[model samples]
Target: MEAYRLLIADVYELAGLSRRTSEEMARAVGQTAARWHVLSVLSDAPRTVPSAARRLGLAPQSVQRVIGDLVDSGHVEAVDNPDHARSPLMRLTGQGRRALDELFARSEDDRAAVVDRAGVTAGELAAAREVLRKLAGALRTSVPHP
Candidate 1:
């Protein structure tokens, strides 16, 4: 049988590295992962805070905090939602777009480094991704929906 401990350790390390990288890049662009994610989501179209929270699987309060920070930083603007007068819609500002562009460039370079270090071919990575997707789907299917 495969060593579950080893798999868990690898997953933990990857998660840590991902978070660290996101934090470093986000700070360099004067934002956090939550803020970045919100801006990215609203880049194409405006969205309500609750919608953004659901997409990110975050608490509404947490998303609200990030949204407030983004608004204070002038990276996003909140406007009245036409569909729902009570709910406000958030949209990205030009500054947010510029920041996202810079972060994406850095992320691309970081991903390239990881791929080179892993020495895994594109085909191998694609196969692994497919397997992981199937596994995730199976797990989700096994769980009863609320």
Candidate 2:
């Protein structure tokens, strides 16, 4: 399991960079990554909490908590879902869109720096992404949908 530990550690370190970057931006903008994700997901169109949760691969409660924060912060709004009266649809505000744009821009710069420092080529990154996608697909198929 030593090899798995090392691989997990490497992934954790890389993920840490993202978390740190997000924390810095969140402090500046006064919004957390969870909140940002909810807003970004709804930036394209309003979505029910369950749909957002599934899209994020997060538990519904976790997504709801973030959505509650966004709503409280005026970054998102909840409107009645015509299809489901019990569930409300979430939509991003203008401020949310601006925040997402800034975060994405900064993330792009950070990613480029990492790629340059690691001497990783675009093709290599693409291949890694493809492999991950296949792995995720296989896992999804293996899991039973409720």
Q: Clashes in each model (backbone N, CA, C under 3 Å)? A: 0, 0
Cα TM-score per model: 0.71, 0.76
- Residues 17-70, model 2: lDDT tens digits: 777877777667666777767777887899998889877778999999888888
- Model 1 steric clash pairs: none
Which residue segments of model 1 deviate by more than 4 Å?
A: 1-13, 120-146
lDDT assessment of candidate 2: 0.80
- Residue-by-residue lDDT tens digits, candidate 1, 1-146: 36746765776798678878888888886678767778777777899988887656568889899889888888888888989998899988898788878877878888888889989889998997787677657766786432
What are the lDDT scores of the predictions, listed in order?
0.79, 0.80
User: Residue 33 of model 1: what lDDT?
Assistant: 72
